[model samples]
Each structure stands twice: as C-alpha cells, then as structure tokens.
Target: MIEVRGLTKTFGPTKAVDDLTFTVKPGIVTGFLGPNGAGKSTTMRMILGLDRPTSGTALIDGQAYHDLKQPLRTVGALLDAKWVHPNRSAKAHLQWMAASNGIPSSRVDEVLRLVGLTEVAGKKAGGFSLGMSQRLGLAGALLGDPKVLLFDEPVNGLDPEGIVWIRKFMQRLAAEGRTVLVSSHLLSEMALTAEHLVVIGRGRLISDTTVKEFVDRSSESTVRVRSPQLDALRSVLTSHGLTVREDGHAASAAAALVVLDSTTDAIGQIAGSNGIVLHELASQQGSLEDAFMKLTGDDVQYHAAGVEEVMGGAL
Candidate 1:
C-alpha cells in the first residue's frame, strides 16, 4: 500500500500540494482526481522523488521511494510517458530501465507482452502513436514486477479500444493484489475504472472515499414524479410539505415533476392519498463527475470553457 501522510510541496511561493493525506490500498484501483494544474503532476513527482516535499512524505510500504533498496521492485510509476527518447526502440527503452534496476533482461519481453506492446517492441518510439506510447510506459512500470504502480494520464490520448484495454488491465492488475493508482481527467472513464476515489481541488484534498459512498453522499438525490395530471400532483405534493418543481426537460415527454425535498416516503404517502397515478417516481441518480463538479467546481484550480462540450461532442 502507498501511504501519503501530509504530503506537501511548493515551487517558490506557490504551494502545489497542501497537507494531502490518504492511503492507497492494494487489490483495488484508486483514482487520483483534480482539475487542471491542481498539482497532480507535482504530487506524482513527489511520490517518485522527482520533486522534493516541502513537508511530510509519501511512503511506499513503510519507506519513501528514494530510500528503497530497489525502488523499481518496490514501486513503479509512469509520471510522464513523454520522457522517453524518440530515437530508441520500445524494447531498448525497457531494457535500459531493467538494466538500471538490476532487473533481468528477459523481464523486458515479459512486460512488453503484458502491455500488448510485443508487436511494436522493435519500432522507434517517435513513430509510435500516443496510445502506443502509453502502452510502452505501462510496460516499463511493470518491468520490475512491483507490488505498487502509479500512472499519470494513462489514457489521455488513447482511442476507444486503447482506453477500454487500459481500464481492464488496470483492474486486472489490482485484482492480482497490486496497488494501482491512476490519475485521469475523464470522469466517465473513472466511473468505470475506480473502486475508490481521492478528489482534489486547488491543491488540497477535498475527499477520499469509496466510489459508491462518495456518489451517494455528495450527489443531490431527488425523486422524479411523472403523470398526466401533473398539476394535481404538484398541488397535492406542495400541500403535503414536499416541495415540487416542474421537470421542464421531462415535462414535454410525460408531464413530470421533480420533488425538491428528500422525503420520498412522505411524497409516496401523499400521492397515494391524493389519487395521483404516478407514471414515474424514482431517484434521479448523479454521476461521480457531477458530484465532483458540485463540490469542487467553484474552486477548480483550472477552468476551461467548451471543454465539457468537446468531451460531450466526442460521445
């Protein structure tokens, strides 16, 4: 497991990461989340000891990454896939890493196969696509057969197939009892991959929780009520202390009302007594991204317009 206790870092006057503390357990995927420039890259660098912490530490198993006898065998990370040389073959790059860490040369082929990079092992990295580079990076991380893994933007530029493959591979790695932590800006992708989440915003830890608990607690749960007699139901619901509002989006389709109150039971009781025939009365579920936006959006370290539209457009 990776234990980050009060891990902090600063660049000159800027505090990149502030008093962040969380535990990343094995056998599950923990998503590291934040808006752009929220210090995610800096924190990952600190974990790998590429950047020094201003205070506290990030420990792997019980010791810092820099203090390990064989850091690769203890924890492997892909902080930036772009760090690789463009001139070198993928296999050669892994071979170099293996040689540096005293890992067996044969493990190079093993990791390449593990990440499905065997076909391109002989190709130069410069000619490889973003998806291929990501695969190569993942291969390097597994070269040591480490118990811990950290990935920063593992699926940033992947195609649909590549994205799907990476998600399953991360899950499969976690199932094999390895600690896997991946950082991503794709909420929909995270909703599928992560079992737990560590949400960060403006360089501070906002939430650390199980995916289900986080969504259930932070999401705004509202009961949906649809009926042909929307007016009667709305009047009856408002009279019974259940604040009701027209679901304008749902209204044209089925004359629906969305209850603003949390008393589903009371709404049911009132609807039954008022002789209201309910077409639909169910909770409107919210996504993890929706909850995150509700919580950290105001203070989102990075704000970009049309990004959501672009992501939506891709769908």
Candidate 2:
C-alpha cells in the first residue's frame, strides 16, 4: 500500500501541494485527478523522493522510497515517458536500469515482450514515436515486476488501441495484488479504468472516494419521462413536490420532462397512479466528466470563458 500523510510541498512562495493525505490500497486501481497545475506531479515526485516535501510523509509499505534497498523492485513509475536518454537504444536503456538495480538482463527482454516492444528494442529512444516511447517507459517500469506502480498520463499520445491495451494492463496489475495509481486528464477513460479516485484542486484535497460515490455525490440523477399526456404528468409530478423541467429535446411538438432527484420506479408509479400514458421513463445519471467539472469548477486555475461558453453549449 501507498500512504501519503499531510504531504506538502513548496517552491519559493508558491505552495504546490498542501497538507494532502490519502492512501492507495493494493488490489485496486486508484485514479489521482486534478486540473492543470494542481500539484499532482509534485505530489508524485515527493512520493518517489524525486522532490523534497515541505512537511509530512510519503511511504510505501511503511518505508520511504529513498530507504528502499532496491527501489525499482518495490515501486515502479512512469512519470515522463520521454525522460530516457535520446542516444540510447530501448534495449540498452532497460539494460542499464536493470544493471543499476541488480535486475537480471533477461528481465529486460521479458519486459520488452510484455510491452510489445521487442520488435523495436534495437531502435534508438529518440527515434521512437510518442506511443512507442510510452510503451518503452512501461517496459522499464515492469522490469523489476514491482508490487506498486504509478503512471502519469500514460495515454497522453496513445492511439485508441494503445489506450485499451494500457487500461487492460493496469487492471491486470491490480488483479495481481499490486497497488496501481494513475494520473490522467481523460476522465472518460479514467471512469472505465479506475475503481477509486483521489481528486484534488489548488493543492488541496477535494475528495477521496470510490468512483461510484463521487459521481453520485457530485451530480443529481435525473429521471426522464416522455408522454403524450405530458401536461397531466407534469402536474402530477409537481404535486408530489418534485422539480420537473422540460428536457432540451422537448421542442414544440416533443413532450418530455426531466425530473430531478427522482428514480425511474418512483416516476413510473406516480404516472401510473395518475393514469398518465408514458412512452418512456429512464434514469440518467451524470457522466464522470460532468461530475468532475461540477466538483472542480471553482478550483480550476485557468479558463477560456468564451471557448467554454461555445463548447459547453455545443456539447
């Protein structure tokens, strides 16, 4: 397990991370989420001992990363897939890392195969595409078969196929009882990949909860109803103290109402009791992207107001 207790980091007068605390349990994939410049990278650096924390602790299995005898054997990370030396071949790079960490050279070939990079293992790092670099970085991370893994934007430049592969790979890692923590901006993919979430904004913890709980808490679920007797159904629903609004799709001829804070069964029961002819009644829960926006609206450090207005309405 990975534990971060009151972790804080400061650079000059700016506080990058502030008194943040969370735990990453094993056998599950935990998503670390935040807006741009939200100190996620800084916190990860602190956890790996690449950056000094202003206060508090970041521990892996009750020991600091720096104190580990063979750090790669305990924790593997792909913070920057492009951080490798440009002059070295992919195979040579992993060979050097393994040599330093006392990992067998044979493990390098195994990891290369694991990441599907064996065919290009002889290619220079600088010549690899972003997706190939990401795969190589993953190969290095798996060289030691560590019990814990941290991936930062592992899908940054990946194609759809690569994205699917990485998602399945992370799931497999967690299934093997390894602690997996990932940080990414793709909320939709994160929704499918992560079981738990640790969301932060402006260097502070906003929420640390399961994905289901986070979505349920952040946005109101709405019950959508379409009926020929929309007027009567609306009155009945309103009389029951439920706030109902015409759905956007309910134009001049459309008869649909979206009931807030309601369930499908309750809506159906009310319509049946009132003899309302319902064509459809469905429960629509908010998406993960919607929930993230609602929770971190104010915490976002930057915004293009005009662009957001245009895109938001269009979306």
Candidate 3:
C-alpha cells in the first residue's frame, strides 16, 4: 500500500501539486486523474524521490521509497519510457535497471515474459513503436516483482489491442494483491480499469471515492429528441411537467429538443401522450469523462465557450 500525506511541490512561484493526500490500497487499482499541468507528474516524481517536495511526504508501506531495503522489489514505476537510450536493446535496458536495484538477471527475463516482450527482448527500445515502448516500460516495472506499482498514463500511445492487454495486466496484478496506481485519459478505459479514483485539478484534490460513486455523484441523465415540428413537440413535452429546452444548433435548424429529467420510460410516455413525432430519443446519462469535467469545471485548462439554448418555455 502507498500513502501520500499533504504532499506539495513548488517550482519558483508555481505550485505543481498541493496538499495532496490519498491512500492506495492493495487488491485494487486506483486511478489518478488531472488535466494537463495538473501536478500528476509532479506527484509521481515525489513518490519515486526523483523530485524533492516542498513539504509533506509520500510513503510506501510506511517508509519513504528511497529508504526501502529492496526498493525495486517494493515499488515499480513507469514514469517516462522516453528516458531509455536509443541504442540499447530492451533486454540490456532491463539488465541495467536490475543491476542498479540488485535484482537478478533471471528476474528480468521473467518480467519480459510477464509483459509479453520476451520475443522482442533483443530489439532496441528506441526502434520500437509507441505501443512496443509501452510494453517495454511495463516489463521494466515488473522486473523487480514489486508489490506497489505506479503507472503514469500507461496507455498513452498503444493500439486498441495493446490497450486492452495493459488493462487486463493491471487487473491481474491487483488480483494478486499488489497495490497499483495508474493514470489515463480515456474515461471509458479508466472506468473499466480502476476500482477507486483520486481526481485532482489545479493542484487540488477534486474527489476521492469509488469509481461508481464518483461518477454517479458528478453527472445526471437527460433525454434527447429530434423532430420536424420541434416547437410543437417542445410545447407538448414541457406541458407534461417535464423540463424542456431547445437545442441551439439543433433547435430551429435540425429541430432537436432536449428534455431534462425525463427517464427513458417517461420519455416514451411523453411521446405517446403528446403525439410528438420523435426522430431520435435517447437517455443521455453522462459518462465518466463528463463527471470528470463537472468535478473539475473550475480548474479545466480548456473549455468550449458557453452555449445558448432557445427556449420553448422554462420548466
């Protein structure tokens, strides 16, 4: 298990990570999420002792990472695969890392097999594709058979199959009762991968909860409908006590109507009773990404401009 307590880092006047506190438990995958420049990399560096924190501490099973008796066996991380030299074969890379940590050469081969990189072990890491590099990085992380792992955006450049394999590999490691903390941008992918989530924005903690609980707390469901006579359909739907709003681009032009707080079944009731010709109707429950956006709204680095909606009538 790993615990970060009030971890903070400042570079000049900018605080990269601040007051970050979270516990990553064994037997589950904890996801770390933040926008670009949101202190994620800073926190990871602090964990590995690559960067000195301005205050607070990160611990691996109650001790700092550098103080561990067998640091490599205690924690494995893939922070930047790009750090590997271009001329070194994947096997040679692992050999050097293993030697640094006193890990045996046989263990390197074991991890290469663990990450399915044994066949390409002789290939230079620089010549490998992005997906292959990701795999090689993963192999290096597993080389020491660490009980704790930190994977920062482990799926950044992988193909679909590689992404799937990485997801399964993380789960398998957690099932063996290892503590695994991973970061990723694909909400759907994270949804399937993480059991717990620690979300951050602007160097502040946004949420820390179970994946399902966090997502549920941040999003809501709405109903979408498209029809030629949108105004009439909007009137009828809004009159039935459901909230209705006219979609701007979809309104007037495509004639689309958005009915808020309308369930899939209730939407059916609205259509049947009002005789509203529905070209499209789907319950639009927000996704994990939407939840992330809502939870981090104030800290979003990029955002679209505010949108306006035409109104048939306010609910």
Candidate 4:
C-alpha cells in the first residue's frame, strides 16, 4: 500500500502540495486526480523521492522510497514514457534498469514480450512512435514485477485498442494484489479504469472515495420529462416547489423539461395529476465528468473564456 500523510511541498513562494493525505490499498486501481497546476506531478515526484518533500511523508508499505532495498522490485513507476535515452534500444533500456536493481537480465525479455515490444526490442527508443514508447516504458516498470505501480497518463498516445489493453493490464495487475495508482486527464477513461479515486485541488485534498460515491455525492441527479404540454408541465413542477429548466438537448417544438433533484416517479405523478401528456420521462445519473467539473470548478488554475467573453458580449 502507498500512504501519504500530511505530505507538503513548496517551491520558492509557491506551495505545490499542501497537507495532502491518502492511502492506496492493494488489489484495486486508485486514480490520482487534479486539475492542471494542482500539484499532482509534484506529489508523485515526492513519493518517488525525485524531489524532497518540504514536510511530512510519502511511504510505500510503511517505508520511504529511498530506504527501500531494490526499490524497483517493490515500487515501479512510469512517470514519463520519454524518460529513456533516445539512442538506446528498448532492450538496452530495460536491461540497464534490471541490472541496477539486481534483477535478472532474462527478465527484460519477459517484460518486453509482456508489453508486446518483443518485435521492436532491438529498435532505438528515439525511432519508436508515442504508443510504442509508452509500451516500452510500461515494460521497464514491469521488469521487476513490483508489488506497487504508478503511471501518469499511460494511455496518452495510445490508439483505441492500445488504450483498452492498457486499462485491462492495470486492472489485471490490481487483481493480483498489487497496489496500482494511475494519474490521467481522461476522466472518461478514469471512470472505466479506476476503482477508487484520490482527488486534489489547489494543493489540498478534495475527495478520496470510490468513483460511485464521488459522483453520487457531488453531482445532482435530474429527471428529463418530455411532453406535448411542456408549458403546463413546467408550471406544475414549479408550483410543486421543484426546480425546472429547459433541456437544451431536446430538439422538439415542445422542449423537454429537466427537473433537478427529482425522480421519474415524482415527475410522472405530477404530470399525471395535472392532466399533462408525457412523452418521455427518464432519470439521468450523474456521470464522472459532471461530478468532477462541479467539484473542481473553483480549483482550476486556468480558465478559458467562453465565446461570449471572447467576443466581449457581442454574441
């Protein structure tokens, strides 16, 4: 397991990470999430001992990273796929890593084949495409067959098939009782990949929970009601003290009404009692993207102006 307790880091006048604490348990994939400039990279670097923490601790199985004997055999990480030497062959890269950690040289071939890089194992790292480089990086991380793994954007340049493969690979590793922590900007992929989430914002912990709990707690569920008596339905809903709004996604002359914080049963009953003709009524569950944006809206460091803003209200 990975445990971070009150972990903090600062650079000059800026505090990159602040009192961040979380635990990643074995047999599950934990996602590390934060907006850009939210100190996720800094925290990961601190955990790996690449950067000294300003205060507090990041421990892998109760020991600091530097104190581990043959750290790679215990904790494997692929923070950057391009960390390898451009001139070195993929085989050479894993061989050197294996050698430094007292890992058997033959294990390099095993990992290469595991990551499907056996055919190009002899090629220069610089010549490989982004997807191939990512595979090579994954291979290096698996050279020791470590019990703990950390990956940052592992599917960054992968195609659809490669992405699915990586997702399943991580899941399989976790099933074998390894502690896996992945950081990625793709919320959709994270939703499918990570079983748990450790979310941070503005250098502070925002949420640490299962994906379902996070979405359920942070996002509002709504019921979409489509009806020919849209106006009557909206009035009835409002009169009943429910928040109603137009469903912008509806394309019909009678726009669909989205009833916030409501259920289909309640909406259907209301429409029925009011003699409103309903066409459709469906409950919409809050998605991961919805929850993420709602929770991290303020913590985002850079905000892109909307079209109206860009046009100075002209639109």
Q: Which of 1 and 2 is the better model by lDDT?
A: 2
Kindly list the per-residue Cα lDDT of model 2 for residues 1-315, writing each as its tens digit: 999999999999999999999999999999999999899999999999999999999999899999999999999999999999998999999999999999999999999999999998998999999999999999988989999999999998899999999999999999999999999999999999999999999999999999999999997799889999988999999999999998997776776899999899999999898888889889999998999999999989988678658788775
Write one digit per residue (lDDT tens) for candidate 4, span 61-157: 9999999999999999999999989999999999899999999999999999899999999999999899999999999889899999999889989
Each model's TM-score, in the order given? 0.92, 0.95, 0.86, 0.97
On a 0 to 100 scale, what is the lDDT of residue 72 in model 4?
92
Pick the winner on TM-score between candidates 1 and 3. Answer: 1
* Number of clashing pairs per prediction, in order: 0, 0, 0, 0
Best candidate, lDDT = 2
lDDT of each: 0.87, 0.94, 0.87, 0.94
Name the best candidate (by TM-score).
4
What's the lDDT of the predicted structure labeled candidate 4?
Answer: 0.94
Model 1, 119-205: lDDT tens digits are 889999989888888889899888899999999999977999989999999999999999999999898999999999988877899
Of candidate 2, the 10-residue stretch with the lowest lDDT total is 306-315
Model 2: residues with Cα > 4 Å off, grouped in runs: 249-254, 308-315
Report RMSD for candidate 3.
5.5
- Count backbone clashes in candidate 3: 0
